[model samples]
Target chain A: MLKCNNINVKNILCDVSFEVKRGSFTSIIGKNGSGKTTLANCIASQRKYGGSISLGNTSMLDISPCDRARIMAYLPQSLPSPNISVYDLVTLGRSPHTSLGAKLNKSDIESIDNALAVTGMTMLSNRMVPSLSGGEKQRAFLAMTLAQNTDILLLDEPTAHMDMHVAAEFTELLNRLGKTLIVIMHDLSLAIKYADNVLILDSGKQIFFGSKKDLLVTDTIEKNFNVRKIENDGEIIFTV
Target chain B: MKKLIIIFTPLLCISIILGCAFGSADIMQLIGNDTDTALIIILNLRLPRVIAAVLCGIGLSVSGVLLQCVTGNTLAAPNIIGVNSGAGFCCIVMLTFFPKASVLLQIGAFAGAFITTLVIVGIASHINAFRGTVILAGIAITAVLNACISFLSLLDSDVLTAYNAFSVGGLAGIRMSQLYVPAIIITGCLLCSLILSRRIQLLCLGDAIAASLGVSISKLRIACIILASASAAAVVSFAGLLGFVGLVVPHMARRISGERTSKLLITSSMIGAILVILADLFGRIILAPTEIPVGIIMALIGAPFFFILLFKRRGDNAEM
Candidate 1:
């Protein structure tokens, strides 16, 4: 389990607390300027924060960078199309586990292959990342993160560059991966549909944190996001 | 990549032979003559010129590769980014004021290069400038340093002979004694950079991604800058601000070696050595006894390459 207790980032986030169960998909939903990325950065240990964030018994801050990378992988929204082949880029994910001069062994190669296969990028493994389309580039980066083989994945707006259909497909892929995920999502309906639990942030405050079913019945999201949630033909949708 | 190394290795050896053999006095003919003047010309002058070419080539190219990777700017080379000019300015000052203390020239050059690199990077980062802006900022810094160099040269007419030869950057009068310290420093820095190539490659992925992959971004960048400064400063101390080897050779190496930093470093070092030796040879033979400077030839080639790169990449991220 990952727990955040009264996490604060000066004026950005204030006393936001939550607990994420292992192997659960938790979607963090918030409007613009709601400090979602800041919270994600704090959990990724990329930024300083007040209060405590722990993984099981140990504090997250105490974990060495290599160990933390081994256990949790974080991907930011803005990705660079580096001029390297997809295979080489995915190979970088094994850095935390490998030594300076060590070559790729059987296990590392297998992990890279599996990541490419899982992301449907196996055919494009030899292609340069800079030549890839936006959605394909996102998949390539996703493959790199998956190759990391971490227990928890923290993504901030991972689908920002993708079209709606591709984004939906990508979300479905993430939903089936069965890893613990804390994703900051902008799409309300997608967040409501696939997330096992939801955390709502409004103006840097934790307005709600509960199971998806419980969240759907409450007015917390609608009040903060200024949107109405409706059910039609057993399908959930949000209208602004 | 293997083909690249194979092709360049022989080319480099041939260039080395040509550079040592056919200077103004034809050192090869003196091999069996057993004359003291011939031996002095061959061993003391021509041989050191060849050695200086190789060392400066490797030093500048490795420095270029490191700067480009760390800054994520394709145009970030020692010459283009004010590092060479800064070192040149300091070396000129050292030669003018403390002519008796020539041993301290490398230290002064390293201090100057290090400070210039930090200042350029600091100002760029402080304003949150993009990659192209960094190059522009470097060019501006280079202009200021060059002006300072010019002012010093004007103030002391005695500094002109050394300053004129040094400013245009040639291998005409290099002695074997000048090559020893710089050779050691360049070799050491190259080894260290090769060993750290893997971590350095991660830097091209950008800070957030590299940090997430367990590499300390700031620490690694600082280490690379120090290495680059040391190598470039060492070269400027002996070779007199030779430009464009750092800028051009890495680009060629990348074409052959792909994006792997280790492979790029090895290929770049070999290719860089070949480029300088051949350029020096051409400078010797192009105008016969007149002998144009190696820096002028490099500028003739590199200025066009830079413009082509700039215009060809105009719509890409590098242009911005």
Candidate 2:
């Protein structure tokens, strides 16, 4: 389990408290400036925060970065395309587990291969990262995070630049990973459809945190996201 | 790539042999008749110059590779980014103030280059450390340092000839003794660079991804800057602001070796050594008895190549 209590990130997030259960896919939904990304960064320990975040019994702040990386992986929204091959890039995920010279052992190679297979990037593993299209690049990064072999995954706007088909495919992959995942999602319908649980942030404050069904019934989403109405014909839809 | 290395290694060896044999004193003439004069010329004069050029080449190019990786700009080089100028300026100041204290010159040069690098990085860090910002900051620093150098030239006309010689950069009068300290420093730094190659490669992915992969970005950046500046400063202390070997050699290496940092580092050092030796050979032979400075020769070759590269890949600053 990943827990955050009274987490405050200066100027971006404040007084946020939440607990993410193991094997749950939680999507953080909010407006553009609602501090969703900040919350994700704070939890990942990428950004400085006031309160406590713990994985099981250990405090996150107390762990070294390399040791912390072995337990959790965080992928940012966008990255400059590195000139290295996809295989080499994904193998970087093994860095935390490797020694000073970054010599990969047998287990590291197995995990790297597993990550490539899981992401369906085995065919394109030899291609240069800079040559990949947007969706492929995103998948490549996702493979790297998966190769980290961490219990918790924090992804910020993972589907922002991806097309609809690719986004759906990626969401399916995430669902099957079975790790504790905290995703910052911009698309309301996608979040509603894919998330096992939902956390709603409204201008740096945690407005709601509960099961996805409870999130849909509450007025919090409508108020926070400026949704005037939500209806279901064949599927649930929101009109903003 | 392997084929290119195979070809280039032999070419480098030939260049070094030719460079050693055909200086002002003819090695062939003194070889059969008087071995002593031949031995002295070959061992004391030509050999050290050749070795110094090769070492300086390796040092500057490795420094360039590190700077380029950390700054994420192909255009980031020791000469262009104010490292060489800063070192040269500090050496001038030291030489002027403490004329007899030769040890202070090298120390001053390293300190100056390191500090100037810090300033450039500091400015770039505040505003995202983008390519354009780093290049502009470098240009500004270079201009300021050049002005200081000119002022120093006017203040002490007696040191003007020595200053001019150093500034132009040559291997004409170097001895075996002069190369010992720089050779040690360069070798040590090169070893460190090779050890850190994996981490440096991670840096090419940009800050966030590198940090996520357990790299301490700030610490790595500082280490890179220190290593780069120290190497460049050491070279400048002996070679006098040799230009473009750092800028051009890494690019040449990349074309042959791809983007793997370890491979790139090794190949770049080799290519760097070759380029400087060849440049020095041309500098010696072109004017015959009156030698051109290797710095001028490098700029003359490097500037045109740099311009062609810039134009050929106009918009893709990140890749080149």
Candidate 3:
């Protein structure tokens, strides 16, 4: 399990403490400025934090960069569609897998191929990333993380601005991966659908963090979430 | 393919060797001899000048590529941080303040580039500045430093005849001592450039991604600044300030090889070296007996190419 102890994420994130178990699908849901992305960046070791963050028995700081990259791969909310071609960008995922002087081997190629295949982006593998559609761009980043083959993934809003069909398809893709996936999202339905555990944040503080059943029973997000309006009957409909 | 690319730099060197050796007509025959004229020109004058052009071109372009990548801005050159002006200002002041001081002039140029590099890095860190800020700081400093140089030059305008010649950047009057250091520096720098090329590409992704990939932001930036400073300093020390090779070479090479820094650096240097040698030849042949400074020729050709680069690309500058 990945553990956060007395962690105070400043700037955007407040005190966020949770345990992410192995092979569990966990999603973090929060409104804008509520610190969802901050929490993910903190976990990914991309941000400075005040408290202890431990992966299993080891401290996050204790991990080497190469080891850290192997342990976790992060996909931020903005998928930077770089100017480089898709194949070259995907090749970047092999950074942690190979040593500085070592040549890439067959297993690495297999990993990249599998990543592209799983993301359903094989046909677009050679295209420039900047030229891709929003959904396709997100898939390319997913492929990068997938190609890294890390044990834990911190995805900040894995499906933002993507249409229902694309979002559903992307989430389904993540759910099937069966990895220790900690995703930050705003969509309530996706939170309810995929999360073995759901975390809700309001104004930088955690409102709830646990199974969806417990969360909805205690404080179901209604009009406050804006996009997802839930009736008192607990019936939820998501709209732009 | 890599072998083919590695061959280009050397092959271009040979072509430059031939260009310097076998030009039209015979200046040697006209000069007072023809017997060991080829050998004399090869050893004493033509060879050293060609080597100067090749090494300086490679150094300048490598420096340009390094800075541009490290800052993640296409506009970022070693000159952006007032480094060139630092060199120029030092040269002008030494020429005015100490008139006949050769040793002090070289020292001044080195001191100028080194100090300016530290200042650029310092400002970049303190301002939480991005690449654009660094470039702006450079331009602003350069303008101020150039003003200082102009004031000094105006004070000694009549006495500083040599300064006028060097300021325009020429291969003329290169001493053996000056040539040796730049050659060694370029060799060492080329090695560093190759090793750090991949890092530059990774770095261009922005600080956050580079950090996540295990690149120490401070360390990479330091390496880049120092390396670029060394290259620009060496070139400025030898031949004064020659602009646009750094800015233009990488863009042209990127058009062919895409954005990979290592490949682009090699290609840029190759292109830059050829461009300089060709320009030097044009300077030689343009009006024969009167050699136009290669710097002016480069500016004439390089300016239009630079605008094309500016238009063809926007770079990763937006985040910065």
**What TM-score, computed on C-alpha atoms, does each candidate reach?**
0.90, 0.91, 0.90
In angstroms, the error of model 3 at A169 is: 1.5
Better structure of 1 and 2 per TM-score = 2
Summed backbone clashes in each candidate are 0, 0, 1
How much DockQ does model 2 earn? 0.55
Q: Write the per-residue lDDT of candidate 2 for residues B184-262, one digit (tens) a residue.
A: 8888888988888878888887667777778877778878877888788778877887888888988878767777887
- How should the candidates be ordered by DockQ, best one leading? 1, 2, 3
Instruction: Give native contacts recovered, as a fraction, per prediction.
Output: 0.43, 0.49, 0.25
Model 3 lDDT per residue over A21-126, tens place: 9999898887888888778777877778888899989999899877898888887776665567777777778777776535569998999999999889899998
Q: What is the lDDT of residue B55 in candidate 1?
A: 93
Q: How well does candidate 2 score on lDDT at residue B34?
A: 96
Give the DockQ-based CAPRI class for model 2: medium
* Cα lDDT tens digits for candidate 1, A1-240: 999999999888999999999999999999888899999999999899999999999999999888999999999988887678999999988888888767889999999999999999999999998899888888898889888889999998888878889889989999988899999999988888888899988889898988999988778778888898898899898989
Interface RMSD of each: 1.2, 1.4, 2.0
Task: Please state the Cα-based DockQ of model 3 relative to the true two-chain complex.
Answer: 0.45
Write down the TM-score for model 1: 0.90
Q: List TM-score (chain A only) for every prediction.
A: 0.98, 0.94, 0.91
Each candidate: chain B TM-score? 0.86, 0.90, 0.90
Alpha-carbon local distance difference test for all models = 0.85, 0.84, 0.78
